[model samples]
Target: MVNSSEQAHTEIGPLYPTYEALRTAAQPVHPSSSARRLLWMLNGPLHSAITVLSSEITTHGVNMPSEPLYDPATDIWHPIAQEPVSTPKVSSVTVGVCQLEEWGFTWCDMHEGHADPPELEDEE
Candidate 1:
């Protein structure tokens, strides 16, 4: 059985397979060609930098912006790519739970709430 935390999914990013991974894949493309493809796909310098460093995998190519011709560039169209970032991106995620039961005040909640002398019920 798959764990709730585990996912049945593929996460394709700027560097999906990774340089090392691409080097080991079944039908590996040339690393230089790969880098060029990656550089071309990115919107600009910062985006390319973030991908080169943070993304799972980037096209195996030399992707310096100032030297476009030094390596050239292109994009590999396929299911492998889902999206591209045009700017430095910060991401966030949310987790959902159905029912989480706690035994006691989990630290501070232990001393919280109106457990002090019960206020005398106002006499009608």
Candidate 2:
């Protein structure tokens, strides 16, 4: 068995500096490489977008009544607070994706719902 003296000598020091160095070094120096740009886009913006979408969908049901909506059945669009449907289930990632797709919402790497156009300038 190891004694206290040996244990003290073997104890490792904090490695935060080393980790930071590695993280900084991993970034590509040149932005001209398409592959690198794609990877960067995926690792950065795409990841962030997915996280936000998952969080929003998990916290609030999809097709919120406060937001503008569309009904494929009638081929009509409803202004916000105009037509409200039952709250959609966004229990899991798959369910969220399905709900979004059903509502004609396309997942965007930069934004959550690409297909849903931004609100009119005056609405803001």
Best candidate (score: lDDT): 1
User: Which residue segments of model 1 deviate by more than 4 Å?
Assistant: 8-16, 25-27, 30-124
- Per-residue lDDT of model 2, residues 1-124, tens digit only: 9998777667843222232343466732222222111211134343222211111232344333232133455765434213211122111121245666656433345476565787777755
Pairs clashing within candidate 2 = none
- Model 2 residue 21 distance off true place after TM-score fit, in angstroms: 34
Model 1 RMSD in Å is 15.1
What is the alpha-carbon lDDT of model 1 when measured against the actual structure? 0.37
Each candidate structure's TM-score, on Cα atoms with residue i matched to residue i, is 0.19, 0.14
Each model's lDDT comes to: 0.37, 0.34
